[model samples]
Target: MSSTAEEKTVMKVAEEEVINESRRNFLKSMAFLSAVFAFSGILGIVRALGPIQMKIPEWPRIKVANIKDLKEKEPIIFNYPLENTPNILVKLGKRVTNGVGPDEDIVAYSQICQHLGCMVRFMPAGSSSEFPDRNLFYCPCHAGFYDADDGAKILAGPPLYPLPPVKLEYDSSTGDIYAVGMGPPVIFGKGPPGSTEVWRDLVGGKLVGGG
Candidate 1:
């Protein structure tokens, strides 16, 4: 073959390789620019929407019963925070925690059972063979028992935790009994997102109010 023909062939191969390289680079740049534009559009949309406002649930002051209406060892059922949430108020007939009025015997607890989310009731002394000497709160389902005097401590059955106490406020002037807030354990199944809020409260080792 002629030297001129050989030179032409080599030049042609090099030119072809260069053209392919340029085409690949152009495609890569186009892809990178497209990703950058898409990202910018998403950011712009987010900025235009402004900051998101989350609505955190706050505890409400619910009227349960008047101070005169209560009797010793009797429990009054009422809803707190919402209409669906059940709680119980009991007149212990003596000073308990921050109990008010002349005797300071009033106390309250969440009716929702800690064991399996069952409704619990007040069991006065002698009502149950278990803890006959003391008053108690008893869950019929799975027999979750809590000591009524000691902040609803777990006494028996599958409940590993105490029942959440209901914070009460007594207006002596008006005779109004108000359900102020929740205490500890997070009230059974009701919790934020992953339902692990109770775990955090438990780890903190104190009675945390539902905020």
Candidate 2:
């Protein structure tokens, strides 16, 4: 082949190689940019969704009954913190620790049994031959018994914990009985029993603590 033809052919091959390299680099850069934009868009979407917030429950001060009308050892059924939650108010007729009322003998407790959420009934003193001295709160479903006097302690039964005690406040002039708060053994849920989870679950959402 002639020298000029050879030179022309070499120059043409070099130019073509450079053009191919340039095209490859341009494609690689575009692919990288596309990947970065897609990643950025995904991050923006996640940020827009925000973080998860858990809801905690709260209790409210509730009026339960009139002190003058409550009979000793007899319970008045009521709800506390929320509607449809069962509770019992009893007049013990004798002073006991952590008891509240005009005579410091009255007490209140949640009726929900700890064993399996069964309802507990009030049993007056001497009502049960097995437990003769003091009044008792009895759960029939699992034979759970709670002392009516001492914060409804787990007396003799399958209950691993005591009944949740309802804190009380009495109006001397108005004769009205108020449930101020709840004590331990709150009720099982996402949080520990009697923990904030109980209140949160009871209210069915995030609750700002209040009366």
Residues 1-211 of candidate 2: C-alpha lDDT, one tens digit per residue? 9999999999999999999999999999999999999999999998999976766444666678887788877789987755656788888889986677768998888888888889999998888887888789999998888888777888888888888888888898998988877776555343565563355446553222332
Q: Model 1 residue 207 lDDT?
A: 28
Instruction: Estimate the lDDT of model 1.
Output: 0.77
How large an RMSD does model 2 have? 8.3
lDDT of 1 by residue, 60-124 (tens): 67677898898899889887655566788888876766466668878888888887789999999
The reply for model 2, stretches above 4 Å from the true place, is 1-58, 188-190, 193-198, 205-211
Q: In angstroms, how far off is 176's CA in candidate 1?
A: 1.1
Instruction: For model 2, state the Cα shift of residue 183 in Å.
Output: 1.3
In terms of lDDT, model 2 sits at: 0.79
